[model samples]
Target: MSDKFTLDKRLAAESVFAAALPLCDVRLMREQRWFWLLLVPRVKGAAEIFDLSAAQRAQSMEEINFAAKGLQRAAPCDKINIGALGNIVRQLHIHIIARIKGDAGWPGPVWGRGARQDLPPAGQAARLTAIQAALAAGVGGDMGPKLSNLLP
Candidate 1:
């Protein structure tokens, strides 16, 4: 495995960078039907959660919870769904989605439900800003220089 971390091409194409956490690179999914975030560990060749060290796994869970809370604050929902299904992506990334009743894919998984509705440029910017702001405010101290700069 290479020491340097590189994001998967498919993930890069489908999401926008939101912030760089200590253990993960936070990204916002392009789908507009629900508020979704991807927490991708910066470890190269880490295809599954087990690939990470014990400390890394703990950090990943913390980051997941952090991102889920930020998502909830940004987009209030009835339920928050989290998953790490890598059947296709093969990347060590956790998905955190805010789900509401009667949404486009209600009572079912969001994957393969229908064609993804990509957010418009303006909507993307607005959602990213909301998420960044929510995360920044939720954290006690500065989220480091990288994350602070990403905040609006």
Candidate 2:
């Protein structure tokens, strides 16, 4: 992460703020029902994972898996969907989604399937607490650079 890094605007618009991980910014998508998280590496002008060095890529995967565990603890699901598709937001970022059997997009992809549901303030706060606790419990070594203003 560098002082020059700034999150992509599209990501800022769609995601609910979460913690900053070792190699990425952990975020919760605004859709309420599913546990969808996004991991954006803090590298300016990086549109692909390969843009990062070998060590950075390894660290990013570690952080992604760590976040997956936290997401699982927060909301258990039938499957965990992870991917990095830059068609929309070109910035190098990964999606870590916990999918249940009968979710909104259950048997289909969440993308372009439906509108994003807004979560209640209480629910959002609770989810955030659970995820943060889970990450804290599972993580080892330096937790990485944390942005004071995690929003956007």
Candidate 3:
């Protein structure tokens, strides 16, 4: 995003899961999984979710739901999970993840599993395109900025 979001160094240290889509207001970075997307809103000096104003909070919720819908279409997940477990990147953000049974670290939390399999370049772009197109056609939003392509 052009809105000058300095990546939280600690959060950046973790592997890039995926490139975010367009519905989210700020940078929605991926955390090295096909099932995971992290949405960090572009509010400066905001460390926690409570730092967001009530209006932004509501808008962010919409953004997150949009993400979930896009994910379900793109990945065909068994279930979708949304939350803000921001122990590292304290920015006011949320995560919308697609969960499936018997995939990777199945039936368990996807926090720390072994070295991650960063999606290959072609695959990443394809998935991003799917998500962006689905969100645009499904919800009528534009991804204002190109997602960072730092995979691998």
What's the lDDT for residue 127 in model 1?
90
Question: Local error of candidate 3 at 40, Å?
Answer: 1.2
Q: What is the per-residue lDDT of model 3 for residues 1-152, given as tens digits with 9 covering 90 to 100?
A: 46666657655553243444432432334444645666777677677777878987786776676667767887788887777877856666677677888777777777686766766666656766666555555542333233333211
Among residues 3 or more apart in sequence or in different chains, the pairs in candidate 1 whose N, CA or C atoms overlap within 3 Å are none
* lDDT, candidate 1, at 17: 92
Candidate 3 clashes: the total is 7
The sequence of per-residue lDDT tens digits that candidate 2 reaches over residues 34-119 is 77889999888888989999999998988888888778878888888999999978999899999999888888888887766887
Candidate that scores best on lDDT: 1
If both were scored by TM-score, which would come out higher, candidate 1 or candidate 2?
Answer: 1
Question: How do the predictions measure up, each by TM-score?
Answer: 0.92, 0.86, 0.73
Q: Candidate 2: TM-score?
A: 0.86
Compare candidates 1 and 3 on lDDT and give the better one: 1
Q: What are the per-model C-alpha RMSD values against the true structure?
A: 2.2, 3.8, 5.4
Taken over the whole model, the C-alpha lDDT of each candidate is 0.88, 0.79, 0.61
Error of 2 at 132 (Å): 0.6
